[model samples]
Target chain A: MSSVGAAEDPHHLAHGHTAAARDEGGIAPKRIVVSYGFWLFLVSDIIMFSAFFAAYAVLVQATAGGPAGRDLFKLKMVAIETALLLASSFTCGLAVIAASARDMDWTQRALGATGLLGAAFLGLEAYEFSGLIREGAGPQRSAFLSAFFALVGCHGLHVSAGVLWCGTMMAQIWTKGFRADILRRLLCFGLFWHALDIIWIGVFTIVYLMGARS
Target chain B: MTDTPPDGKRPWQNVWRSRIRTSLSYVDGLMRSVALATRRHDGVEDDAHGRAPGPAAALDAGGANDHAPGLDPVAHRASLIGYVTGLGLAALLTAISFWVALDRETFWQPGVAVGLCVLAAAQMGIHLVFFLHLTTGPDNVNNALAVAFGVLIIVLFGAGTLWIMSNLDTMMLPPVPR
Candidate 1:
């Protein structure tokens, strides 16, 4: 088998020039592909959310004449969730910028901030879910409750994954610095993070806000 | 023509023939109009020359002029206007959606509700086109393709699930139990 250096040597000039040109163009092909991968992942994620949306639509009135969304949903809490998630997305953007600039300190700080805000958003959601469950509206209580749990729980799970992923990336950045691989990973993470914000906008509109009023 | 198959037939031959015919007519009409315009512009000059000037010379001159940068203030203003107008439209739509969602009693009419859903979808599209810059450049092809695939899967799965679940509800839990 050829050594790594041997494999790179033949294509080194060509690849270097192309990579430099990409950088000069204000976007790296690696970064672009990484962003596309995130989008593909988000598409799969949207499939999951789509299932949740369908469930919610079918069970929107499955309250069994008990406590409906109007009774349970608090717009204020949801607003906070929105704020936290949006802020996390903003920080995730900043993290991407920092990574691009190779500013390790700012990248770490921005990613750390994103992780914290994501955690806060997840916490609020968990609180909301648990509070509803404590009030005799658990998932097992009714179909409406079940659908609600599944939908919101899925998003909460995504936020949890994002937080863990961000934390891991932050550790890698802190220890190894902003390597190309790490930057690619962070680019994917940024897309995933922002996609969540977009999904949350849908959830807020269809489930919480509309449900509350209906 | 010399590369015909042993069977003296090509499956794609029919398809190519039809497509080429359609494309040829389009190109012919376009070129004819271009020729007519050029003739009108060079009426006197064309008479002066015993024959039309060489196409190569005209092409070279045109290409040189094309390379010269021209003031594009209008395009710049148009892009700015597109951005600002897009954002305001999105915000306005969001506010209206919120208002409707909050006042559901009045907006719950079936037709109105569906309209609102359509409006929301439109607003999402506007956000994609304007703020996300999804189709702003050649490099964005991958981005657009990814988004399209994602949306297709999501819509298919979401709608399918809803349909199946609703059917199950009717079949399993009839209003009047058997």
Candidate 2:
């Protein structure tokens, strides 16, 4: 399908089916192209995270006889952060749904909810990091602490970037009013947001839940 | 356009809606998506029919037959039911993991950690299927290939590193295992 006039078709608007058959010379629809591109980027991102996961696994036991994750970790705070990120992901999905339907009002509301939840998660993470620093369990103290900070901090940085992207998207939608390019951007944002939540699943499982036990 | 009235005037539907109305409307929505996802194509073009995706569904006037018959334009809506169900399952998994982790004394030692791994994997699968819409559809072949390749590399890198590092640690310590 030609990307230019695809959306202008009334049937496409009503149905939103962008299926590209194998015979279509390998060119997917614009929506699928952007979404699939983002999917590859996410896969590469996961590969990068696995390196840190390996590092953390190897170094988690090398605490240099100081405080370990069991001694310094707080499960309660980590649980809260996980919940916030999960909720934000759901809200981001809702925002995408609303954007697809061209419901400006609900899209903005859902995006706003996502941003607030994400910011709250960041606030809690910052609080946890500062508390660790104050308690003399900072990253400089041990190899384990450094690995922990690098893995979790990388995920936190992604969340920060996602929140900023979401804000900019809200503004673009408000001004451009659901243009095709804007909608593609919205799709990428939704995928990115969901990808971050998936990574957090790994972070909490490996770093917090398993780390505390091991 | 296929939305049937909630009124259970049909003799069979009377029992159905009565039993179902106690729960939120999500049950019906879930069933609908399940139906759509598993719908049979049977060599006929599925989108070749004039079925429009249900969008603005509640607010849309019942002009269901405006399109010409057999005019199938390809497009699909991301079902809201799928997202809600994904969220529900993920939340359940998270709660269970936390409960297991917090009450370590209640369960066996190493089993809890392994259980957390299973739960995390389950939750990640849920997010991929529902939120990311990963599927076996023809258009998704390339995406699936990319994911499979990435997973292969990750497994090799992570497992290989752990194996070597653990062996190195044991050799370094030469501990009381002797």
Query: What DockQ values do the models have?
Result: 0.11, 0.22
By DockQ, who's the top model here? 2
Off by over 4 Å in 1: A1-28, B1-96, B103-133, B160-178
- Tens digits of per-residue lDDT for model 1 on B53-94? 343233323322311011111111012233345446666776
lDDT of model 2, residue B174: 48
Scanning candidate 2 chain A in windows of ten residues, the lowest lDDT window is: A16-25
Residue pairs in candidate 2 whose N, alpha carbon or C atoms collide under 3 angstroms? A16-B75, A16-B76, A17-B74, A17-B75, A17-B76
Q: Which ranges in model 2 have alpha carbons more than 4 Å from their true place? A: A1-26, B1-74, B173-178
lDDT at A152, model 2 = 88
lDDT of 1 at B15: 82
The Cα local distance difference test for each model comes to 0.66, 0.77
What TM-score does candidate 1 get on C-alpha atoms?
A: 0.64
DockQ, Cα level, model 2: 0.22
Tens digits of per-residue lDDT, candidate 1, A140-197, equal 8888889888888888898899899999999988897766577667667766776676
